[model samples]
Target: MGRWAVATERRRGEALIRAIHEAVLAEVVDAGLGQLTMEGIARRAATAKTVLYRRWATPFELLIDALGEAYPVEVPTPAADNLRTDLIAALTLLTDWMVTPAATAVMAITSERGRYPELAEALWDKVFDPRGGTFTTTVLRWYAARGRLDPARLTPITTQIGEALVFKLAIDNARTPSAEEVAAIVDEALLPALGL
Candidate 1:
Protein backbone atom coordinates (compact mmCIF):
# COMPACT_ATOMS: atom_id res chain seq x y z
CA MET A 1 0.00 0.00 0.00
CA GLY A 2 1.01 3.62 -0.51
CA ARG A 3 1.73 5.65 2.62
CA TRP A 4 -1.68 7.35 2.51
CA ALA A 5 -3.44 4.06 1.84
CA VAL A 6 -1.56 2.46 4.74
CA ALA A 7 -2.65 5.27 7.04
CA THR A 8 -6.25 4.85 5.88
CA GLU A 9 -6.06 1.13 6.51
CA ARG A 10 -4.79 1.74 10.05
CA ARG A 11 -7.66 4.15 10.63
CA ARG A 12 -10.05 1.43 9.48
CA GLY A 13 -8.46 -0.99 11.92
CA GLU A 14 -8.97 1.54 14.69
CA ALA A 15 -12.64 1.81 13.68
CA LEU A 16 -12.95 -1.92 14.18
CA ILE A 17 -11.53 -1.47 17.65
CA ARG A 18 -14.16 1.14 18.41
CA ALA A 19 -16.91 -1.12 17.08
CA ILE A 20 -15.86 -3.94 19.39
CA HIS A 21 -15.95 -1.52 22.33
CA GLU A 22 -19.46 -0.33 21.47
CA ALA A 23 -20.62 -3.90 21.19
CA VAL A 24 -19.27 -4.74 24.62
CA LEU A 25 -20.78 -1.59 26.12
CA ALA A 26 -24.17 -2.58 24.76
CA GLU A 27 -23.77 -5.94 26.50
CA VAL A 28 -23.19 -4.13 29.78
CA VAL A 29 -26.64 -2.54 29.53
CA ASP A 30 -28.33 -5.67 28.19
CA ALA A 31 -26.55 -8.31 30.30
CA GLY A 32 -23.65 -6.75 32.25
CA LEU A 33 -19.94 -7.68 32.57
CA GLY A 34 -20.31 -11.44 32.63
CA GLN A 35 -21.12 -11.35 28.92
CA LEU A 36 -17.87 -9.74 27.75
CA THR A 37 -15.56 -11.85 25.62
CA MET A 38 -13.65 -11.58 22.33
CA GLU A 39 -15.98 -14.03 20.62
CA GLY A 40 -19.03 -12.11 21.78
CA ILE A 41 -17.47 -8.83 20.70
CA ALA A 42 -16.59 -10.12 17.27
CA ARG A 43 -20.07 -11.61 16.84
CA ARG A 44 -21.73 -8.35 17.84
CA ALA A 45 -19.35 -6.23 15.76
CA ALA A 46 -19.94 -8.58 12.77
CA THR A 47 -16.22 -9.07 12.28
CA ALA A 48 -14.05 -12.13 12.82
CA LYS A 49 -12.38 -13.39 16.03
CA THR A 50 -9.13 -13.88 14.15
CA VAL A 51 -9.13 -10.17 13.20
CA LEU A 52 -9.55 -9.15 16.83
CA TYR A 53 -6.91 -11.63 18.08
CA ARG A 54 -4.45 -10.43 15.46
CA ARG A 55 -4.90 -6.86 16.74
CA TRP A 56 -4.99 -7.69 20.47
CA ALA A 57 -3.29 -10.37 22.52
CA THR A 58 -6.08 -10.30 25.10
CA PRO A 59 -9.44 -8.71 25.87
CA PHE A 60 -8.19 -6.39 28.63
CA GLU A 61 -5.67 -4.78 26.31
CA LEU A 62 -8.45 -4.31 23.76
CA LEU A 63 -10.68 -2.70 26.38
CA ILE A 64 -7.91 -0.26 27.40
CA ASP A 65 -7.71 1.23 23.91
CA ALA A 66 -11.52 1.42 23.91
CA LEU A 67 -11.40 3.65 26.99
CA GLY A 68 -9.13 6.11 25.20
CA GLU A 69 -11.44 6.26 22.21
CA ALA A 70 -14.56 6.51 24.38
CA TYR A 71 -13.27 9.38 26.47
CA PRO A 72 -12.79 12.64 24.61
CA VAL A 73 -11.97 14.14 27.99
CA GLU A 74 -9.78 16.98 26.86
CA VAL A 75 -8.89 20.10 28.83
CA PRO A 76 -11.48 22.77 28.15
CA THR A 77 -10.00 26.03 26.97
CA PRO A 78 -13.25 27.98 27.12
CA ALA A 79 -13.22 31.74 26.60
CA ALA A 80 -15.31 32.65 29.63
CA ASP A 81 -13.40 35.41 31.43
CA ASN A 82 -14.58 34.39 34.87
CA LEU A 83 -12.39 31.49 36.00
CA ARG A 84 -15.06 29.95 38.20
CA THR A 85 -17.62 29.87 35.42
CA ASP A 86 -15.08 28.39 33.02
CA LEU A 87 -14.09 25.72 35.51
CA ILE A 88 -17.70 24.82 36.16
CA ALA A 89 -18.43 24.52 32.44
CA ALA A 90 -15.40 22.33 31.88
CA LEU A 91 -16.09 20.00 34.78
CA THR A 92 -19.80 19.78 33.99
CA LEU A 93 -19.03 18.66 30.47
CA LEU A 94 -16.74 15.99 31.86
CA THR A 95 -19.39 14.54 34.16
CA ASP A 96 -22.17 14.75 31.61
CA TRP A 97 -20.35 12.47 29.19
CA MET A 98 -19.65 9.86 31.86
CA VAL A 99 -23.31 8.83 31.88
CA THR A 100 -23.16 7.93 28.22
CA PRO A 101 -23.00 4.43 26.69
CA ALA A 102 -19.37 5.22 25.88
CA ALA A 103 -18.76 5.45 29.60
CA THR A 104 -19.93 1.85 30.04
CA ALA A 105 -16.86 0.87 28.06
CA VAL A 106 -14.72 3.12 30.23
CA MET A 107 -16.02 1.49 33.41
CA ALA A 108 -15.54 -1.99 31.93
CA ILE A 109 -12.00 -1.19 30.83
CA THR A 110 -11.11 0.23 34.25
CA SER A 111 -12.64 -2.76 36.01
CA GLU A 112 -10.57 -5.11 33.86
CA ARG A 113 -7.37 -3.07 34.10
CA GLY A 114 -7.10 -3.56 37.87
CA ARG A 115 -6.29 -7.26 37.36
CA TYR A 116 -3.78 -6.60 34.56
CA PRO A 117 -0.81 -4.28 35.03
CA GLU A 118 0.02 -3.83 31.36
CA LEU A 119 -3.62 -3.11 30.60
CA ALA A 120 -3.71 -0.63 33.48
CA GLU A 121 -0.64 1.12 32.14
CA ALA A 122 -2.14 1.42 28.68
CA LEU A 123 -5.43 2.88 29.93
CA TRP A 124 -3.74 5.23 32.39
CA ASP A 125 -1.21 6.51 29.89
CA LYS A 126 -3.66 6.95 27.04
CA VAL A 127 -6.91 7.76 28.84
CA PHE A 128 -7.07 8.49 32.57
CA ASP A 129 -3.64 10.04 33.18
CA PRO A 130 -3.76 12.46 30.26
CA ARG A 131 -7.30 13.66 30.97
CA GLY A 132 -6.66 13.98 34.71
CA GLY A 133 -3.37 15.78 34.07
CA THR A 134 -5.03 18.17 31.64
CA PHE A 135 -7.96 18.81 33.99
CA THR A 136 -5.52 19.53 36.82
CA THR A 137 -3.70 22.01 34.60
CA THR A 138 -6.93 23.71 33.51
CA VAL A 139 -8.24 24.08 37.06
CA LEU A 140 -4.88 25.34 38.39
CA ARG A 141 -4.60 27.87 35.59
CA TRP A 142 -8.10 29.12 36.34
CA TYR A 143 -7.30 29.38 40.05
CA ALA A 144 -3.98 31.13 39.46
CA ALA A 145 -5.61 33.63 37.17
CA ARG A 146 -8.17 34.35 39.91
CA GLY A 147 -5.29 34.82 42.44
CA ARG A 148 -6.68 31.91 44.46
CA LEU A 149 -4.20 29.26 43.38
CA ASP A 150 -2.71 27.15 46.14
CA PRO A 151 -1.30 23.69 45.61
CA ALA A 152 -2.82 22.49 48.86
CA ARG A 153 -6.19 23.89 47.82
CA LEU A 154 -6.50 22.24 44.41
CA THR A 155 -7.75 18.85 45.57
CA PRO A 156 -10.46 20.27 47.76
CA ILE A 157 -11.41 22.71 45.03
CA THR A 158 -12.05 20.03 42.40
CA THR A 159 -13.47 17.37 44.67
CA GLN A 160 -15.96 19.75 46.20
CA ILE A 161 -17.05 20.89 42.77
CA GLY A 162 -16.37 18.38 39.97
CA GLU A 163 -16.15 15.16 41.93
CA ALA A 164 -19.40 15.62 43.80
CA LEU A 165 -21.20 15.78 40.48
CA VAL A 166 -19.43 12.60 39.42
CA PHE A 167 -20.26 10.78 42.65
CA LYS A 168 -23.87 11.90 42.55
CA LEU A 169 -24.31 9.94 39.35
CA ALA A 170 -21.95 7.11 40.26
CA ILE A 171 -23.32 6.62 43.76
CA ASP A 172 -26.79 8.10 43.62
CA ASN A 173 -27.68 6.75 40.16
CA ALA A 174 -29.09 10.04 38.92
CA ARG A 175 -29.81 10.17 35.20
CA THR A 176 -28.26 13.51 34.29
CA PRO A 177 -26.90 16.50 36.16
CA SER A 178 -28.44 19.87 35.40
CA ALA A 179 -26.90 23.26 34.64
CA GLU A 180 -28.50 24.74 37.76
CA GLU A 181 -27.05 21.94 39.87
CA VAL A 182 -23.60 22.41 38.36
CA ALA A 183 -23.83 26.11 39.10
CA ALA A 184 -24.95 25.39 42.65
CA ILE A 185 -22.10 22.93 43.07
CA VAL A 186 -19.56 25.51 41.94
CA ASP A 187 -21.07 28.26 44.04
CA GLU A 188 -21.87 26.39 47.22
CA ALA A 189 -19.12 23.76 47.15
CA LEU A 190 -16.20 24.82 44.96
CA LEU A 191 -16.16 28.47 45.96
CA PRO A 192 -16.10 27.55 49.63
CA ALA A 193 -13.06 25.36 49.04
CA LEU A 194 -11.26 28.35 47.51
CA GLY A 195 -12.48 30.35 50.52
CA LEU A 196 -14.21 32.76 48.18
Candidate 2:
Protein backbone atom coordinates (compact mmCIF):
# COMPACT_ATOMS: atom_id res chain seq x y z
CA MET A 1 0.00 0.00 0.00
CA GLY A 2 1.06 3.59 -0.61
CA ARG A 3 2.01 5.91 2.29
CA TRP A 4 -1.25 7.79 1.80
CA ALA A 5 -3.26 4.58 2.15
CA VAL A 6 -1.26 3.55 5.23
CA ALA A 7 -1.88 6.93 6.82
CA THR A 8 -5.62 6.65 6.18
CA GLU A 9 -6.08 3.50 8.27
CA ARG A 10 -9.23 3.70 10.40
CA ARG A 11 -8.95 4.42 14.12
CA ARG A 12 -11.46 2.98 16.55
CA GLY A 13 -12.17 3.12 20.31
CA GLU A 14 -9.50 4.89 22.41
CA ALA A 15 -7.34 5.77 19.43
CA LEU A 16 -10.15 7.59 17.64
CA ILE A 17 -11.22 9.39 20.83
CA ARG A 18 -7.65 10.51 21.52
CA ALA A 19 -7.33 11.95 18.04
CA ILE A 20 -10.69 13.69 18.36
CA HIS A 21 -9.72 15.05 21.79
CA GLU A 22 -6.43 16.37 20.50
CA ALA A 23 -8.20 17.87 17.49
CA VAL A 24 -10.72 19.69 19.68
CA LEU A 25 -8.01 21.12 21.93
CA ALA A 26 -5.96 22.23 18.93
CA GLU A 27 -9.03 23.70 17.29
CA VAL A 28 -9.93 25.67 20.39
CA VAL A 29 -6.42 27.01 20.73
CA ASP A 30 -6.05 27.84 17.04
CA ALA A 31 -9.62 28.96 16.32
CA GLY A 32 -10.79 30.07 19.79
CA LEU A 33 -13.71 28.57 21.69
CA GLY A 34 -16.34 30.71 19.96
CA GLN A 35 -15.00 29.62 16.60
CA LEU A 36 -14.85 25.92 17.42
CA THR A 37 -17.16 23.76 15.30
CA MET A 38 -17.75 20.09 14.62
CA GLU A 39 -16.58 20.60 11.05
CA GLY A 40 -13.36 22.25 12.19
CA ILE A 41 -12.58 19.49 14.69
CA ALA A 42 -13.43 16.72 12.22
CA ARG A 43 -11.22 18.40 9.63
CA ARG A 44 -8.37 18.60 12.11
CA ALA A 45 -8.74 15.03 13.29
CA ALA A 46 -9.19 13.69 9.73
CA THR A 47 -12.53 12.18 10.75
CA ALA A 48 -16.08 12.79 9.60
CA LYS A 49 -18.22 15.28 11.53
CA THR A 50 -20.72 12.49 12.02
CA VAL A 51 -18.10 10.61 14.02
CA LEU A 52 -17.84 13.55 16.41
CA TYR A 53 -21.61 13.80 16.78
CA ARG A 54 -21.76 10.10 17.61
CA ARG A 55 -19.95 10.77 20.88
CA TRP A 56 -20.60 14.43 21.69
CA ALA A 57 -23.60 16.66 21.12
CA THR A 58 -21.49 19.82 20.79
CA PRO A 59 -17.95 21.02 20.29
CA PHE A 60 -17.89 22.44 23.83
CA GLU A 61 -18.70 19.02 25.27
CA LEU A 62 -15.89 17.54 23.21
CA LEU A 63 -13.57 20.27 24.41
CA ILE A 64 -14.46 19.63 28.06
CA ASP A 65 -13.74 15.94 27.64
CA ALA A 66 -10.41 16.76 26.03
CA LEU A 67 -9.46 19.03 28.90
CA GLY A 68 -10.45 16.38 31.45
CA GLU A 69 -8.38 13.81 29.59
CA ALA A 70 -5.39 16.13 29.54
CA TYR A 71 -5.73 17.36 33.12
CA PRO A 72 -3.10 15.90 35.48
CA VAL A 73 -3.94 14.40 38.85
CA GLU A 74 -1.47 14.96 41.65
CA VAL A 75 -0.14 11.75 43.17
CA PRO A 76 1.19 12.42 46.64
CA THR A 77 4.02 10.36 48.12
CA PRO A 78 2.01 8.08 50.36
CA ALA A 79 4.94 6.51 52.15
CA ALA A 80 7.03 9.63 52.37
CA ASP A 81 5.78 12.62 54.35
CA ASN A 82 7.44 15.34 52.38
CA LEU A 83 4.75 17.96 52.07
CA ARG A 84 7.00 20.58 50.48
CA THR A 85 8.28 18.19 47.83
CA ASP A 86 4.80 16.94 47.00
CA LEU A 87 3.39 20.45 46.87
CA ILE A 88 6.18 21.59 44.56
CA ALA A 89 5.62 18.59 42.33
CA ALA A 90 1.90 19.34 42.10
CA LEU A 91 2.52 22.98 41.14
CA THR A 92 5.18 21.83 38.69
CA LEU A 93 2.58 19.67 37.04
CA LEU A 94 0.35 22.70 36.80
CA THR A 95 3.12 24.76 35.22
CA ASP A 96 3.87 21.99 32.75
CA TRP A 97 0.19 21.66 31.87
CA MET A 98 -0.08 25.44 31.53
CA VAL A 99 1.92 25.25 28.32
CA THR A 100 -0.20 22.58 26.65
CA PRO A 101 -2.94 23.05 24.05
CA ALA A 102 -5.55 21.74 26.49
CA ALA A 103 -4.50 24.31 29.07
CA THR A 104 -4.65 27.00 26.43
CA ALA A 105 -8.17 25.96 25.56
CA VAL A 106 -9.11 25.99 29.26
CA MET A 107 -7.75 29.49 29.64
CA ALA A 108 -9.71 30.57 26.61
CA ILE A 109 -12.91 29.22 28.12
CA THR A 110 -12.27 30.76 31.57
CA SER A 111 -11.16 34.11 30.19
CA GLU A 112 -14.36 34.47 28.26
CA ARG A 113 -16.55 32.77 30.88
CA GLY A 114 -18.93 35.72 30.99
CA ARG A 115 -19.71 35.14 27.34
CA TYR A 116 -19.88 31.35 27.79
CA PRO A 117 -20.89 30.79 31.40
CA GLU A 118 -22.21 27.31 30.76
CA LEU A 119 -18.99 26.21 29.15
CA ALA A 120 -16.99 27.53 32.10
CA GLU A 121 -19.37 25.83 34.52
CA ALA A 122 -19.06 22.56 32.64
CA LEU A 123 -15.29 22.89 32.66
CA TRP A 124 -15.29 23.13 36.47
CA ASP A 125 -17.96 20.49 36.99
CA LYS A 126 -16.49 17.97 34.58
CA VAL A 127 -12.75 18.63 34.43
CA PHE A 128 -11.40 20.37 37.52
CA ASP A 129 -13.81 18.87 40.05
CA PRO A 130 -13.18 15.33 38.91
CA ARG A 131 -9.40 15.82 38.95
CA GLY A 132 -9.05 16.65 42.68
CA GLY A 133 -10.31 20.21 42.31
CA THR A 134 -6.95 21.96 41.91
CA PHE A 135 -3.23 21.55 42.11
CA THR A 136 -1.89 20.78 45.62
CA THR A 137 -5.35 19.89 46.92
CA THR A 138 -4.76 16.18 46.66
CA VAL A 139 -1.34 16.50 48.20
CA LEU A 140 -2.62 18.62 51.04
CA ARG A 141 -5.43 16.22 51.74
CA TRP A 142 -3.03 13.30 51.73
CA TYR A 143 -0.80 15.00 54.24
CA ALA A 144 -3.73 15.96 56.41
CA ALA A 145 -5.18 12.48 56.50
CA ARG A 146 -1.82 11.14 57.66
CA GLY A 147 -1.61 13.75 60.48
CA ARG A 148 1.35 15.36 58.76
CA LEU A 149 -0.86 18.38 58.23
CA ASP A 150 -3.73 19.65 60.31
CA PRO A 151 -7.07 18.98 58.64
CA ALA A 152 -8.26 22.40 59.79
CA ARG A 153 -5.51 24.00 57.75
CA LEU A 154 -6.69 22.28 54.60
CA THR A 155 -9.33 24.91 53.96
CA PRO A 156 -10.37 26.29 50.61
CA ILE A 157 -8.03 29.27 50.83
CA THR A 158 -5.02 27.17 51.79
CA THR A 159 -5.62 24.63 49.08
CA GLN A 160 -5.82 27.37 46.47
CA ILE A 161 -2.59 29.18 47.37
CA GLY A 162 -0.24 27.29 45.10
CA GLU A 163 -2.56 27.43 42.11
CA ALA A 164 -3.48 31.07 42.62
CA LEU A 165 0.15 32.14 42.89
CA VAL A 166 1.19 30.02 39.96
CA PHE A 167 -1.52 31.57 37.81
CA LYS A 168 -0.75 35.06 39.04
CA LEU A 169 2.94 34.71 38.26
CA ALA A 170 2.19 33.24 34.86
CA ILE A 171 -0.22 36.06 34.05
CA ASP A 172 2.15 38.71 35.31
CA ASN A 173 5.18 37.26 33.53
CA ALA A 174 3.29 36.05 30.46
CA ARG A 175 5.07 32.68 30.62
CA THR A 176 4.85 29.40 32.45
CA PRO A 177 6.74 29.56 35.72
CA SER A 178 10.06 27.74 35.84
CA ALA A 179 10.80 24.79 38.14
CA GLU A 180 12.55 27.13 40.56
CA GLU A 181 9.49 29.37 40.63
CA VAL A 182 7.23 26.39 41.25
CA ALA A 183 9.41 25.35 44.18
CA ALA A 184 9.40 28.86 45.57
CA ILE A 185 5.62 28.95 45.42
CA VAL A 186 5.43 25.76 47.49
CA ASP A 187 8.00 26.99 49.99
CA GLU A 188 6.92 30.59 50.30
CA ALA A 189 3.21 30.58 49.66
CA LEU A 190 1.77 27.10 50.19
CA LEU A 191 3.85 26.02 53.14
CA PRO A 192 3.34 29.27 54.96
CA ALA A 193 -0.39 29.12 54.37
CA LEU A 194 -0.52 25.61 55.76
CA GLY A 195 1.42 26.80 58.87
CA LEU A 196 4.42 24.66 58.03
The CA lDDT of each predicted structure is 0.64, 0.89
lDDT of 1 by residue, 1-196 (tens): 5987876553256577777878756755555555567887778877788988987777666666666677765454444246576667666766777677766665665576655557557766877776654333466555565655655666644544565555585567555566776677777777677666
State the lDDT at 47 in candidate 1. Answer: 79
Tens-place lDDT per residue, model 2, 24-110, is 999988899879999999999999999999989999998988888999889999775788888888899888888899888888988
- Per-model TM-score on C-alpha atoms: 0.71, 0.95
The local lDDT score (0 to 100) that residue 181 gets in candidate 2 is 90
Global local distance difference test of model 2 = 0.89
Best candidate, lDDT: 2
Ten contiguous residues minimizing lDDT sum, candidate 1 = 72-81
* Candidate 2 collision pairs: none
Model 2 weakest 10-residue run by lDDT:
78-87
Off by over 4 Å in 2: 2-5
